[model samples]
Target chain A: MLLSVEDFGIEFHDHDSPERVVEGVSFTLDKGEILGIVGESGSGKSMTALAIAGLLPRKKLKKEGRILFEGEDVLTMERHKLRGLQGDEICMIFQEPMTALNPTMKIGLQVEEALRIHHTEMNDAQRKERAIKWLKNVELDDPERVYESYPHQLSGGMRQRVMIAAAMVGNPQLLIADEATTALDVTVQAQIIKLLQKINKESQVAILFISHDLSLIRQISHNVLVMQNGHLVEKGAVDDIFEHPQQEYTRKLISAIPRVEL
Target chain B: MKKWLKKHKNFNFIAGAIITGVLLLTVLIGIFATPYDTTQMNVADKFAKPSFAHWMGCDNYGRDILSRVMEGMGNTFLIAVLTVLIGTVFGVIIGALCGYFGGLLDDILMRINDVLFSFPSILLALVIISLLGTGRLNVTLALGIAFIPSFARIVRSEVKKQCSLDYVKSAALMGAGHMRIIFVHILPNIMPVLLSSVMIGFNNAVLAEAGLSYLGIGVQPPAASLGRMLSEAQSFLFTAPWYAIFPGLVIVLTVLGFALLAEGTTEEE
Candidate 1:
């Protein structure tokens, strides 16, 4: 297994009574597997992603389970070790492409930054080449033009592609895409999903895809985990969950997606 | 360039730019060349009217008013620049730390900041001057320290707002350390805000330096300063009104230049 969570739970120690965000959420992701986490608003799906990546705030937070990446507990690991895993081993792409980029930095430099942070031995020229290569890999038509442009200069879909390029350039073992395509329109959304699928097949990097859309999840993910109110409601292969949902919550969620009937 | 300026649609900016540009020329010219030596006193020519020979007339000491005004402006401008430098460096550091990691560190730092901020800047500066002793360096140091809370407050607010943005989270996920995220990610985004604040700070610094000198605790004599010229001209106001009038006019113009420039630049936000 590339990643594993054993009885993993998260609670915010914000008030007199600690409020639990995620509880008893246990799952495993194998190498090159695409695991889709589906949920509604206030569901703990995004929180679980943050916990696995160690991106949660360091203050007034409580964790009550083991998150083992390569058999080493992520919760118990040193900060430096965790950082080493973050960008180099496991990368994340967020939802808002417009705000996810540094507005002042050129797209090329920002993409190059991923490689620059992990590989100290690589020269600027080498980093630049890799960045452009990844940008092209994401199928941006004019990699050179997009590379030189600022974040604000590009459209939302283009910026999302640049973001993906930056995430992929680092050659991470796991890519956690948290609502990565939700901001785009349907056409752009389909294009991004296609790009993510292609990257997964070529690179064999495990993907933890978090999204609220069941249809989008079904399109790309191999396996699925349904969440409701900070708890994992169900977990199975995509076909099994759609055709034979065992839990009422899972059935309700699957049925919520409107279908066209002849 | 023309297109960008027209997009701003701020007349205050253009007027401020023209005045500031002219003043900058005068200050630069003052460094290398002035109409007459600032210290060249002509008791016979004292209280002379504004004319081709003495465009701003002469003081009671018979010193050329125009030369003194030029030299004094340079001194005042330099002090303001140095004060702002000190404020920006220290204030940005404090603000970034408070902003990026805001649990206990924010509470502690901001409370101290509030205490410092509560004092009227001029009063705080005066207290500092009383302890540090009177000189250009000392006065600049005092004003700069006084200015820190304001810069820190603005930067802190900006950073706090930015930290909530997804880009900061993205940077963290990229294994960027605190320094990288604060300086590279957040600071660059807040430059427009910081730049305008710096401009306003410059305006305040110029006036504060003049205020200090007027009270006889800043920019010592034998060295020309706008404040010192005004103070000296007060006794001879009736004898040579131009002495006080010219220096006072320069001070107002200097302050207004920055105020207008700040308004212009602030509109970009």
Candidate 2:
């Protein structure tokens, strides 16, 4: 497994009360495969991603799990080692591209920042050059203009493309895309997914794509993990789960998708 | 850029311009002019009327009011800049720590802030100046302490908000440390707000200086300050009104400059 999560659980503690937000989940992703964790809001799909990355709220959230990234227990990894791995080894793309980006920052410089931090060997001109290259790869029109423009200047789809370029530019082995395309319109969403699909195929990067849209996940993901109220109710090959859902909740969720009647 | 400026349609552009223009004029005029030395107390020219020789007239001490106002503007600006630096540096650190770490640290820092907040800012400054004694440095220190809670509160809130953002979580999952996430991702995001707050704080710093000087706890009389001028002019208002007029205008313009800059940069984040 490229990434193996064993018996992971997360509990968020409020000053007033403490409760388990996510409990007892296990999954694995092989090299270059896409794993989709699908559920409604509060189902803990995002939380699961956060736990594997070891980015849970340090003080408020209690974690118990073994997350193995290439046979290394990431849960127990030293902070310095973890820091080196983030962006360089595993990166994330947030949902709302505009809010996710530093508004005042130029798009190209923002994209290059990940490389600058993780790959300190690269100088300013080299980073800028690579950023422009990736900008074009994302099929952004006028890469130079986009590079100089701030986050607010870019359209939502364009901003998400910039984010995708930034997240992928670091050449991370694993990419966690949390609702990465949900903020865009349906057409823009399809374009972003296409871009992501292209990147995953070309780079052979493993992706954990978290989204509420089942059909969208069905299109991109190799395996689907159906989650309900923080529990992994079902998991199987994307084709298998879609064809013959073993769990009632999974079956019900799949049935809820609007169908066209002749 | 002109179209963008026009689109704002807010008091920000025009008011900001007038404010900056006035302050710039003060700085420029100060650099090149003198019917009498700002500090020179010539008993011969004492209390002279407005003329080409002394446009703003003379004070009771025979110092040229225009020269005094010019020197005062420079001193006032120096104090505001220094105090703002001290306050903002201290505030950002405290706020970042309290907001990021939370728990007992946040509680302790916030409680301290609450205590400071309760003490009317000017009164707190007065008390500190009274205790530390008076001077430019002391006034700056007092004013800085008085203004810190505002910045700290704003920074703390910004930190808390940024901390919850998905990118911050994403950065963390990737293995970025708390320091890296805080400084690199979070700090840069919150900076626009911080910049606006700093501009506002600068305005407050000038106002605080004037208040302190007027109350006799700021820059001593040999120094020219708008507030000191106002206080001195109170006694001579029946005779020479220009003593108060020029310095008052300077203070108004100074505050307006910072206020305009703050407004222009407010939406930057």
Reference contacts recovered by each candidate, as fractions?
A: 0.71, 0.56
TM-score of chain A of each: 0.98, 0.97
lDDT by residue (B55-157, candidate 1, tens digit) is 9998887788899899999999999999999999899999989998887889999999999999999999999999999998899999999999999999999
Query: How good is the docking of model 2, as DockQ?
Result: 0.49
TM per candidate: 0.97, 0.90
Using DockQ, give the best candidate's number.
1
Question: For candidate 2, lDDT tens digit of each residue in B33-109?
Answer: 74467888878877888898888889998888888888788778888899899889999999998888899989988
Fill in the DockQ of model 1: 0.80
Model 2: per-residue Cα lDDT at residue A96: 87
Model-by-model DockQ, in order: 0.80, 0.49
